[model samples]
Each structure stands twice: as structure tokens, then as C-alpha cells.
Target chain A: MKRILATLLACVLLLSCMSFAAAEDKKTLTVWIPQYQFSKAEDAISDQDFWDGVFDPFEVENNCEVKVEIVGWGIYGDTFFTSLVNEDGPDLVYVTDNYDLVKRDLLLGLDPYLTQEQKDNVILWNTAPENANGEKVIVPMDDGVAIGYVNKALLKEAGLDELPVEWDAFIEACKTIQEKTGKRAFLQNWGATSGTSALMLAFWPYYFQAGGKMLNDQGEIDINNEAGLKTVEFLKSLLDAGIFTEDIVTESESVDKFAAGEVAYIVADLNKGNSAFTPAGIDWEYVFSLKGPAGYGARTATDSFAVNKKTVARGNDELAVKALMYITSGAVMDEFHSKIFYLPPFTKDASFVKDEALYALTSAHSEDVYVVEEFSAKKSFEDTLLANIQEMFQGNLEPQEVLTETMDYYNTQLKEN
Target chain B: MQKTFFSRRRRQALIGGAYILPSFVLMFIFNVSPIFLSIFYSFTKYDMTAAPVWVGLDNYIKLSQNKYLGNVLTNTVQYVLITVPIQTILSLLIAAFIAGSLKNRYGSFLRSVIFIPVIASLIASAAVWDTMYKPDGGLINQFINLFGAPSVNFLGKKPTALPSVAAVSIWKSTGYYMVIYYAGIMNVSTEVQEAAIVDGASPIQRFWYITLPILKPITYMIVTLGIIGSFQVFDLVYKMTGGGPGRATLTVAYMIYSYAFQDKRMGYACALAVGLLVVILLIHLIQTLFFKERDAK
Candidate 1:
């Protein structure tokens, strides 16, 4: 009886060890994405549910577990960097630009793993800087072009038949809307804090329209020219005329007011137009961009997926690239952009948008939209520029002083870097 | 016998050290090490991605030449002046009033009610205050509209932004210091108060002569904590104004955050942090000396 019991115990131990080894063999690919609004995912219970459903098929096909952690945009950059420095970062991440990662040698080059079919399957923005060996480190995901959103109902109430396409006309339209309706005609959030490149939406398009150049022939940031001064002066004129109130410095969300039909016009990105107006069923239309001396120029933004170099060290680089490609694949991007109403930059020959006006506005401006290239001093430059512009609106600084001080600061940062 | 007793004491000391080892290790790693590391990094140009390069006095020189530094320092000092005295005086008065006059269930209830804001998180408090400070149809604007007043943007204007943020700090912290003062007041001897009263001292006179003197040490401690806390103000400014409407609400702590996190200029931020520490230490030293001189007199 004792011998039989010993044999049974040994058999049980062997089975338990086998199960433990099998569990250890399984690998988890971690991914971090910011919480983006899914305006049309009413059937999806939560963000996790939507993401898990999207990744479920990929996970099944690879027979590997995909760990997706949805992070808040406020702390996403800090979290990623902190984890990266600790050498325990996620295998894949959604980042707007990966220049810092590439410069630090913390990004895996996807050139080797990308098949020719995969390369031809989607459009590549190549916004992120090439690696030391001139390899692509980012896969483009979505593109956001700066555009003006106007409340059609409010415009109609103010007796405007068509939206303005020029700087002076836009100002006149704002005045007429505010004078007739007694509602806020225009407001933009200038108080977007750290981690947000808010000036791109609120100030860059206007600056570009005014014939400003972000970089000169010397390839240095040179926005201290006549156009830069004019842009600030014009914005200050709006504030002076009561078209834009002094409250814009703290107006962190113009979309909420726009969606509620309290504001007639706001300069924002493409995604915001659908995210706010469609869900609320507000009557709104998009203006590609207002025209100034430089003609139409809208700032375009492309956020992409990047594989961490640590994935290579862990021997999971191929799998990480595969997952990145799969997520950015044309069919998947079409489905994803349909839910969030974002402009999918990678996907081609797929149309999920049914709204004629939205489709026309985005497609018509695709060829002319410009993207501000990545620079070492971009964040500091934007931050100081926003403050100087705010100071101009507050009447503390002249438009000339605003441009001088901001440009000087930007130049100093460039020199130091 | 003396040698045996010394050995016994040494054994006891070893046992005590063993008991505290885990906590000491953690504290050293998290707190003590970072402070020394910051001091070292203050002299280097580190962005956390690449290894730190020695920059000597470069960061400090740039900080001195920085046009915004003067304004940021002035704003921090302004915040400290606005919050410290107001919160200290308000807390002391409320504590004295409750402990002296309304020393009953109602007093306890009031104490609890006053401390509610203290327990609330700073982020939540700032969010609620932001809503109240909004110009269009916000609670404060709606209230003032009934009296035929125009809407005032509290956070949008440079003149009102720092003061508005400071007001939130005062509201949230007055109760905390009030609790401390109340405890200190409760510890005051009844005999001393009785003696003063019997000696023809009025209520105010007794409080002035007896309770106030007894609470002097607590006052000094509270003032020190208040100065340190107000000087390092970040969360309120971060949540409320973002050091904006053009550097009107820029504090040193917020500047450090902007440099370290937003700009990724970690070494520059560390230098700024070290400068702030020296200023704080000097202020603490002055306060300590002043209190000591007064006590000696």
C-alpha cells in the first residue's frame, strides 16, 4: 500500500511540473495606447472591450497573449519614458513622434521584418526620424489635419449663407454671428498644458496661412519673420474686438461649447469635428482652412505605432513588428477609424465615412496639408510660444515683443541642444 | 559588572538596528538617494535618455539669464506671501474661537465640517474650483449675474489668476493647520488660564497672555511647514492656471516640472530644484533664529 501511494504521488508531481513549464513558455506582448474617444462604438461596453475585440483575432492567430494597457493622455509620455529608462517598457506603443526614442537607440527598426506586401499595403508618413542606420522606426496610424469647425445652425441664424474662406472674411463672419446671436462666435483652448502640442491646432494653421516658415534655409526654427508678427497681431485684434474673449486663456475645451451650440466657430483638428458634432447630432460643417497671404495651409499630424528596442533584446522583435503591421493594416485601420471617426493615414481604397461634407473636407485638403517636422526643441518652443501669445492677448506684451521674446527663447533652446 | 552592562546594551542596540533595517533600506533608496542624486545631476546635462554629461555651472548661468526666471520667482514669492500669512492667521483664529467659545457638540461638528476640505484631494478641489471660476454660466458667474454684475474670468486674467489659485490653497489648508492649533490649544493648562482670569484678565487678555504664549512653539512649527508647503506649490498652479495667462501664475515648482517633464531638461530642472532648496533652507534658518531670539528675550 505504501509503494502504491508513492507511485501515485510521483505521477501527480510530474503532471504539475509539465503544466507549470507550459505556462512559463507562453509569452505576453504588452502594448500601451492613449484613451481615444470612440464616438460610434455604442455597442462596445468599454474601451477595453473594443480593444480586446480588435486584438482577439490577432492574438488567436499568433497563439500569444496581447496585454493592452489603455493609459490617460496626461501621463502617457511620462509613464512610457519612466518604464523605458527602467528597461521594462511595453513591447509596442502608440506615439505621435519617435525621434526621442530613435535618438536614444530605444526603438526597433521595422525595415527588416516588414514584408514588401505589408510595405505596399499602406501609406507611410515617415514623420519620425530615421534611425542611425537610416531605418524606419515608426508605422503611421492616423492623420489629423487642422481645420475650422463651424456651427451651421448658428451661422444660419446669424443670416450667413456661406462660411468664410479668408482671414478678413472670417473675422467679419465672427462679428456678425456674435452681434446677431449674442452667443460666443469663436473660442480656442490656449491653456492646453504639458504633453499637448496645442499650438499646432490653435496657432500654427493661422501662422502658416500668414506665410510663416517654421524652418528657414539654414534648417533652423525661424518663425520670427513678418508673418509671425502678423499672425499674433491678428489674433490680438480678435481679442480686442470681443470676438475672442479674454477667457480663452483658460478655455481648455472649446469642443464642449461648440457641441452645445454656444460657439459658432473653433479651429480644431479633424477628429474633434466628428467626435463632438456627430455624437450630439449638432449641425456643423468643416472648413479646410482659412486663407491668408500665403493661401491655404493646414497643419497635419500623424500618430504612429513604434516597437521598443527591448523587444529585440527579448527576441520578440519579429512578433512586435507583426502586431504593429497587423493593427495598421488597411482593413483593420478602416474598421478602427470607422469607430473613432479618425482619418486613417495608412489604409487605402476604403471609405467608412458616409458624411459627404466630412469626406469632402478631409479628402480635398489631403494634398496641401503640411506637417511640422520633429525637432529637439519643439515642446519648449510651443510652450513658450503659447505663453507669449497669451500675454499678447492679455495686453501685457505687444505683438512684436511676443514674437521677439518667443523667437529668442526658441533660438536659445536650439543653440543649447 | 560595567563591562557586562555595556555588552548587554550593545546587544540591545544591534537588535533595534535589525528591527529598523528594512524601513531604513527603503527610505534610503527612495528618499535619501534621490536627494544626493539630484545634487549631482544639477551640475550635469541629463535628459534621462542619454547618459548625463558634465555641464558645470551652465544650467545655473542659463537660469540666471532666463527672463522668465525672475517672473517665476516673483510669482512663487507672491504665492508664499499670499497663502502663508492668511492661512496661518485664519487657522489660529478659527481654532481659538472654537476651543474657547463653542466647546460643545456643535463645536465638534463645526470642526469636522471645517476639516472636510482638508481631507479632499487637491486635484478634486482644483477641478471644483475651476468650475466655480468659469466665466460663462458657471456657479459664481450665475450668482453675480443676479446682482447685475458682468461675468469675471477669475483664472483667465493675469491679475486675478495667482490670487485665485492662492485662495484655493488657503481654503484647503486652513482647516489642516486649524486642527493642529486646536490640539495645541487643548494641551494648554487650565490652571494658567484660571490664574490669569482670577488676576482680572479678560477672555481676550487670558488668551493673549496664556494660550498664545503656550502655543508659540506650535506656531513656529506651523509657520515653517506653511512656508515650505507654499513655496513648493505645484498641483494647484498646474491644475488651475498652468503658469499662464503669460507667467502670471508661474511658480518655481511648476517651472521645475515644465523643464524636467515637458522639456525633458532634467539637469536644468534639478539645478532649479537645488536653488529652491537653498532658498527654503535659508528661510527656515532665519525663522528658527528669529524664534530663538524671541524665546531668549
Candidate 2:
């Protein structure tokens, strides 16, 4: 009888071991990203090291293993959406822009996963709203805004001690720089209809300067008044002055020229300035939107992340939320920003602004930093306006004509939608 | 005897069917199915994340209204019209020259060298071309500058970007077409060439009268291939200019990619793609009909 009991006990132990192994295997979570953070030893050490350090600690603390799958950036957008639709998606993904989450129902909402206290801790500006189905799909990983970068040396050469503080002064400064340095003064990415998007970044500051709002609370097109026309005229005058690069609509061509010091000032996303200028060892300074006649500084555009509601409903909510919080947390962001020289979205104290150039710009423009509303009613209208602006830059349409055409387009879109 | 004869015929038919089964199955699964699916999707709106919604002819209607589509279509036609004829003529000339003059071994070596790009991966060749087309540091610009020409933003300017991309496509495919023509030249009977030489016909005159007319079939083949290839041109444009300098290099395929992948307008993209396919098919049909008539005459 004792021998029989011993055999039964051994069988029970073997069965339990098999079940435990299966359970462990079932707990595996998959994360997808564009590229492996570290492919080269040096790149691994300098850039990807922080991701490993952050995730490794989190894994140990959470008692879960995380698997990462690297996809090429070129194909990631299509592949990620396709995988999500199939319900064979990853637990976490890195998205380049917030529109990816807002436009597609690919992410999970984190509301149910996080405690009220935890939700409250997140920056309000970074929180993405749910769709009609009520899913808070994405968490903003970084704050990206378009800003102007001025070459300090060029400004000094042009006998300017301080950067331009007003619209008129800005234009004069550009002219002075052009005359003195024989270099293109203002350069922007402009080419096709999409080039209009970059121009809108610069256009926003002028709109604010002219006391014109782009959209009202209801998200109607509001740039139909005198303020809007003034903004258009200002853009035209700049173009006429030959201050902007000839290839204003092209991507990165003008920015590249600026980086090579062929242009004195460039309008680009803050992230681009950080990446191109800082790494290339070009001495540059960020300029806040110059105060126009109305003395208002326009806010730059904001892109964020969202969670997919479908993923949340599948009981992966907690893990996904935790991953979102971890990536967006001040510490992880600070590491990413410092390494890549990107501007962090988190509130900056004296300690946060360690880089002198970054500190000076952020501190000075702290109150002026405006966030573009992520959800706009007239999104399509905004796209049309952008295209018209490109036409203006191309000299195919006069600025006034383009603005009028844009107003008509916006009116039509508003009526249709 | 009747039973034996019937059984033998049936067995022969079965053997022939068995020989083609693998190829037929593979083609159906890989090629035919995808084509049909694409056609079906073209009539629907598929955003990749949700079920496709049927929109019928709406996508085609929208395509007609799209101004950018018109521009890209024009660009594509220009590319086909210019690159096809020049590439065919250049390849034929080089093939004829090599076939007439060069030693057999040297000719083969030279042909191989020229065809190296044909075998080289499109992405790799595009990367090399990207450097060569760079406005500031590209080899093309340097050569132009050496000739006392001003620097031109070949890929950055709208007027030049499409032509520039076309030039690269021509350069890469020229040798492949040349090899095809070379084969055609080789097949020309030696007796005919010897007779032409004995009649004291000049090389150019002999080539024009004898070689050119005889190579009509090869020319037709090249034209068909060029039309299909040029319309499907995506990878090189994607890698090099990304249809940029403000949609200057935008082709139908690239537009479909942007709509499907970037904008998530899969239905619209599919419609655009289907439209392109139809256009290509129509062109091919017209060309075939005309060429067949010409050959018949």
C-alpha cells in the first residue's frame, strides 16, 4: 500500500509540473517596434542602452517576461494595423504620431486599467480620448511641436544682438541676415500639398499674431476675417522677399541646407532641430513665435499616442497601461530626449532643463507653448488650407487667391462633413 | 483492340495534365487569387483595421476628380512615352554594334557588365542612384558643374524629379533590353549578313534594312515589357525620391501606397490600383492589336 501511494504522488507531481510550464508559457507578452533599439555595439551603448535598462528593471519588478519584435519603419504602419485587425496583435507598439491611433482603431484604452490616482498623475495634454465605442486607446509617449531655429552666429553677423521678438522685426532680421551673409534667410519644407502642413506650422504663429484663431470651439473654420488675410499677406511678403528657400515644399532639402549653414533660420519640428542641429554640431537656438501686432504667440502642433479599446477588452489592459505609463513617464522620456536630443513633454524644472540651449528656449517660451488641439472638427478643412498655402509658395496662386480658395474649400468641407 | 486504344489515349491525356498540374496550382494560388482579391477590394473601402465596406464606383469617381491623380497619371504617361522608345532604340543600337564588331568572348563579357544592373537588386541600385542624384554631392551634379552648368536640384524640383527618376529606370533596364536584342541579332542567319556585305551595303544601311526589320518581334516584346514595368514602377521611386519635391515623382502605385498605408484609405487605394491596371490593360490591348496588324501586313 505504501509503494502504491508513492507512485500516485509522483504522478501528481509530474502533472502539476506540466501544467505550471504551460501557464508560464501562456504569460508571454509581445511588443512590436520599428527597429531594434540597438543594432550596433556603439549605438546599443549610447542610444538603446536606456530602453534595455528601463525594461529590464520593469520586467524584474513586474515579474513578467517581455518579448520584442522589430519591424522596419517603412512597413510598420501597414503591418501593425493589419495585425491588429486580425486580433493577433502585440501587447505594445511604438507609433510615430498620434493620428495613427486616432484615425485607426488599432490601440487599447487604458481608463479601466489605471486607478483614478494613476490617471490623474498623467499629463492632461498627453491623454487621448476614446472613439464612439469609448476606448482611451493611446498614451502620448513624447510631446512633438514645430518651432523655429535661428543660427545665433548668423544673427550676430547680421548685427543682431537679440532674436526677433515681433513679426515685423523677424522679417527685417531675415532681410538683414540675407543681405549681410548672402545666405538664404528663412527656409521651410514646402513642395506638394503636404508641404502646406509645414507652412501651417509657421502660419499658426502669424495667425495668432494677427489675432486670428484657426478654429473655434465647435471646430469651424475661423480664418476668414481680416486677421487671416493679414497672415496670408505676411507669408506672401516673405516669399516675395526671397527669404524662404526656393524649394520650400520639398522635405528636408531646405532643412539640410540650413544644417549646412546655407540658411540662417529654418522652421522645423522641434524634434528635427534637436536631431539635426545638436548632433551635427551646429550651434543653433530655438525662437518662440515672434509677437505679432496683436502680441499673441501661437501654439505649435501636438502629436500623441492612444490605446486600442479592443486590446483593453481582452484583459491585457493592465499590462498595456503599465507599458504606456512606463514609456511616457518623466524618467524614461528624459532619457530618450537627452540621448536623442528631443524635447521632452514633461514639465521642466531647473533640473529638467540641463541643456543650456533647451533651457533658455523652454524657460522663455514656457507660457507661450500652445498645444494644437488633437481632435479638430475641421481636420479636412485644415488639410485644404495647407494645400492652398503650398500653392501660394509655388507662385501658382497669389496668397490672397489661395486664402480665398482655401476659405471656399473649408466651407465646402464643413458643409459636407 | 478498341479498349486498348481508348485506354492508351486516356493515359496520354492524364500524363500531360499531370505535367502541368503543379505549375497551374502554384500560379492560381500565388498570382491569380491575389489579382482577383485586389479587384474585389478595389470596389470596397478597406482600412486594414476593419472589415472592408463596398463603395462600388465611388473610388473611381473620386479618382477622376483628384487633381493630384491627374498629375501623377500625366507623369506616368510621359515616363512610358519617353523611356520606352529611347531605351528600346539605345539597346538595339548597342546590341547590333556588339553583335557586328566585338569578339565573341569580349562581347559576352561586355554584355554581362551592362546587364549587371538588371540582376542587381532594385533597392541596392536605387541607393546608388540616390547618391548620384544628390543635388549637393551627387556625381550627376558634379559632372554637370564640370561642364560649367549651374547646380540643379534634380530630385527636389517638380519639373525635373519625374524625368530624373525615369532616367535611373532607363539606365538600370537598358542593358537587360540590350541583351534581349543581342540574342535577336545572334539569331539572324549569317548567310544573309554575308550576302549584304558582298552587295557592298554599308554597316548602317545593312543594319537599317536587314537587322531592324527582322527584329520587329523583339521590339514589340520590349515595348510591352516597358509599358508594364514603367506603370508598376514603385520601389525605385519609393527608395529614391518618395514621390516628393511635392508629389513631383508621385506615381499611381505610390499614391495607392500612401492612401492604403499612410492614410488608411484602403478602398480608395484599391480603386486607384484597379484603375491603373485597367489603363495598362487598355494600352496593352491597343498596342497588341496595332502591332499584330502591322506584322500581318
Candidate 3:
């Protein structure tokens, strides 16, 4: 009887060791991000400090080994897709809004892993990812707003007391600034070719304010309408006024010109207020949306994080779910905002930013913030529009001609796709 | 004995073949194989991630309909036409000057100076040029201002952007071609030049009649190299302009990159690549037909 007991005990111990080994094997996770996103000023190859501070803490807390890999931003999307299709990608990936994950069907749906209560805890309205079928795909980190950053000193030199809140007034202010300062009042980083996204960022506010929609609910291009024509005319008027620099067609970094005080007002992301404008030490302030005839506001794109479904099926679903939770949590979201100086998407009861100039402008334009869901489609219509706009910018085609051509192209693409 | 001799010859042939077997296999695997595979891909509709679907000659048909192709083709032709002649002529001139006038030590030092740009990284040089082309405080504008001329936007204006980029290409490659010409000039018999001088020919006349005629082979080589190099231009344009201010500088190479990588239209990019290869092959065949070496005495 004693011999039998000893054999049973040994068997139990062996089973326990096997189970422990299996558990340990499940703990490893791989993460990938663009090399430039990490602070690697000295070494260039590795950001040991960032890894030790930001990533290592999480790894220890979660009892996992986090392998951080650097990827080039230009090729990241293509590389990520290739890796995913081959089923050899990292468990987590860092991507920008350019990915349009939902429409592409490239990312995993996290809904199956989370409980209803957990899903509810996630700020769905702000962070929810919409698939091509309008299904939620991932949770967003933040919603960005594109606003006009005006150099107050430059404006004052042009005899402007405050930022203009109307189209005509804005144009007049630009003319005045140009006349007085002998500098370009308005500048954008496109030289002869209309960069679709950059043009959209600059001109979409006017379109929205004019009660124009790029695409209707039926997926028809609406830019050939009267409102859209007016938007084009407005852009042409700015160009004709000599308010734009001569090389506006080819200028890659118009923001640098704004930073150098060569332009009074520039259309840029709100995050630039800290990282770009502030670092340059320019006395700049944000301006509210200029009122158009339709009384609508501006629209901006967003970026989100997504999971790989195949990874979940590989038995690390629990860890992946936990990682999603950690990244999208209020604390982590706030940290991202602080690091990037971007507007946080999640709702937190923190004190309002006390920068009087920024607060006043942000509050005034808060109602005008529109989220564009153009990325929710499998194929982007933006490319076609950009090509047409480029022709217009190059003076090869008239603005109206561009609009008509772009509308037709977009319609064809939608119909076929 | 006759039977044994035939067997030995066969054995020798087999051994010779075996010696080159690995290289032949590698070449077929890496170079020849990929070209055929790419041709197959060109006849398909591939999105890189997904399996390719056969579409007959759809990619070629689609290429004809593509509006951007016209601009890309125009840009590529302009680049080749402008850069090749300029680089070849400038290098030949510089080589002639160095070979004729300069003493040995100074000539080598000057040649080394030109070769420095040839050895320098293209991407790094392009980046420096990008900064120098900046409208605000770039060195180019500063120099332009010194000339009592209005600062012209070099890369910003559509009409000038391509030419501006071409200038950088010429600057980078002229030195390489110069080295080739210098070597060619060295090989030319000094006796012929002395005879030309004795015949009451001026320095320029001697160079035009005697030196140039003799340097035909080098000229042909330079022209061919320039044509091939210009067609494959990517790194400089990518770093400097990104094929923009609306595809002003977009070449077939850049377009292929955009299609295969950015747009994920792998089949289309492969079709473009195949088209480029065919064009290059035709040019090379033409060059070979015209530039064959004369029978040596």
C-alpha cells in the first residue's frame, strides 16, 4: 500500500511539472512599431532606455517577454499585410490612420474575447473600430482634429487683432498679412500636385461648412455639386491672391515655413501645437472653424489598434485581450496623449487645459469636429480625387474639370469594387 | 585508340560543364527564373497578400487606360534624354581637359575630387540637396539671391522640378563617366596626338578629329551606361521629391514601387517592370547593333 502511494505521488509531481512548462511557454508576446516612434537619439539602432522603462515594466507586470521590433514607416503597411497573410506576423502592431484596418479586413475582431461588461468599460464611441461592413474591428487611441495654427506675432504685424471666424475675413486677413509682412499669409505643402489627403485636410472644412459631402449614403461622389465648385473656387482665389508661396505645388514641408514665420496661418494637426510649433518657439494660437454658408465644420481622420484573429486561435487569446485592455485603458490613453501632446479620445474628469488661447478656440470649434468614415471602405476614393486635384494644381485642367473627372472616377471605382 | 579519344573528349566536356554547373544553376534560379515568374505575374491580378488570379492581357490593357502612365512615361523619357547627353558630354570634356593640360599629380587629385561624388551615397547626397533646395533659407536660394536674381523655387515649380532633380543626377554620375573617359584617353596613343599637332591642327581641331574619333568606343559605353542608369533612377527621387508636387518626377521605377508596395497592385507593378525590361533590352540591342568594335589592325 505504501509503495502504491509513492508511485501515485511521483505521477502527480510529473503532471504538475508538465502543466507549469506549458503555462510558461504561453507567456511570450511579440510587438512591432516604427523605429522613429521610439526615442533612440544616441544609439540609432536600439532604444534601450525606452525598452527598459516603457516596455520592460509592462513585460514584468504581465509575466511575459515583449520582443520589440523596429519597422520602417514607409513600408510598414505592406510588410504588416505580407506578414499577416503568411501567418508569421507579430502579435501586436503599431499603425497609423493610413492603414484603414476595418475596410481592408486585415485586422482581428476583439469582441469575441471581451465580456459585455469589459466592452462597456471600453469607451466605444471614441475608440470603436468600424469594419467594411460597418462592424467594430478595434479600439481607437484618439480622434485628431485639424485646425489653423496662426502666429499671433505675424498676425499683429499684419494689423489683425484676432483670428477670423469667416471665409471672407480670413482671406482679407491673409491679404493684409502678405501686404504688410511681405511674406506668404497662407501656405500648404503641395507644389503643382494636389496631395489628396493634404488638400482634404485644408479644403474639407470649407466643403463641410458649405454643406458638401464627398460621398453620400449611397456611395456616390458629391464633389461635382455647386458647394464643391465653390470650395474649388475658394482654393483658386487663395492661389490667385498671391497669398500662397510660388512653390506651394512642390513644397513638401510647408509646416517648416510656418514654423519659420514665413506664413501667418497654416492648416495642421492640433498635436503640432506642442511638438512642432511650440518647439520652434513661435507665438502661435489656434483659430476656430471659419463659418461657411452651411454653418457646418471640419472633418478629420483617426487611427486605431487591432488584433490578429489567427493569433487568438493560437491559444494566447487571454494575453492578447489583456494587452488590448492595457493599451486602451484611460491611464495608458492619457499617457499616449501626454507623450504626443494629442487630444485624448477617452473621457476623463481631468482639469481643462488652462492655456486661455487654446481653450477658447478649441471650445468654440468643439461642435464642428466631424469624423470622416471614408476609410471604412475597402478601396479608397481619395487617390482618384488627389490625381484630379493635382491636374488642377498644375494648371493642366480647370478646377471644375478636375471635380467632374474625380467624381466620375470615384463613381466608377465604387460601382466596380 | 579512336574510341578512347572520343570518350576522353566527352569526359572533358562533361567536367567543364560540371565546373560551371553551380553558377548556371544560381543564375537560373535568381535571375532568369524571376523574369519568367514576373512575366507570368504581369498577366494576373495580384494584391501581394492574396493569391494572384489570371486575367489574360488585362494588365497591359489597363496600362493603356491609366492616366498616370502618360505622366510617368514623359518624366522617364525626359530624365533619360536630358541626363544622358549632359553627363556624357560633360564627363568627356572634363576628361579631355585633365588628360591634355594637367600634370600627373594634379590630374590624379582633380580626378579623385570628381570620383568623390561618384563614391558618396546617393541617398545622403539627395537629402543634402533636399535641404539646400528648401525655399526659406536653403543654400541654393542664398546663392541665387547673391546673383541679384529672384530666388527661384527649384523643386517646388513643376516645370523646373524634373530638371532640378536631373541636375543632381548629372552631378552625381558625371564623375563616374569622367573616370571611364580618363581611362579611355590614357589608352589613346600619344603619337597620334603629336602627329595631329605637327599637321598644323589646333588643340580643339586635334581633339575633335583625332581624339574624339578614337574615343568612340568609350562614348558608346558611356551612353549605354547612362541610358541604363537613368531608367533605374529611384533612391534620389524618392528621398528628394517622393515623385510628387503631383508626380512631376515620377518615373516607371517609382510608379512600379507605388503600385507594388503602396497601392498593393503587384500584378500591375510587375507588368510595368516587364515593360521597362523590354524597353531596356531593345535599347541595348540597338546599342550593340550600332556600336560594335571595328576590326583591329
Q: lDDT per residue, candidate 2, A125-177, as tens digits? A: 34455655775655543344456788887888888887776777788888989
lDDT of 1 by residue, B31-115 (tens): 8999899999999999898889999999898888787888989999999999999999999999999999999999999999999
Worst 10 residues of 1 chain B by lDDT: B257-266
**All candidates in order of DockQ, best leading:** 1, 2, 3
List the global CA lDDT of all models.
0.82, 0.70, 0.72
Q: Given the true complex, what DockQ would model 3 score?
A: 0.25
Q: What TM-score does model 1 achieve against the real structure?
A: 0.95
| Candidate 1 deviant stretches above 4 angstroms | A1-16, A38-42, A194-197, A272-275, A278-281, A349-351, A413-415
Task: Give the higher-TM-score candidate: 1 or 3.
Answer: 1
Structural similarity to truth (TM-score) of each candidate: 0.95, 0.84, 0.85
Interface root mean square deviation per prediction: 2.0, 5.5, 4.8
Residue-level lDDT of model 3, residues A158-223, one tens digit each, is 888986867777788888888998987877655413234555577677888877876677754567
For residues B142-198, what per-residue lDDT tens digits would candidate 2 score against the true structure? 999999998787776777878888988888999999999999999988899899999
Question: Whose lDDT is higher: candidate 2's or candidate 3's?
Answer: 3
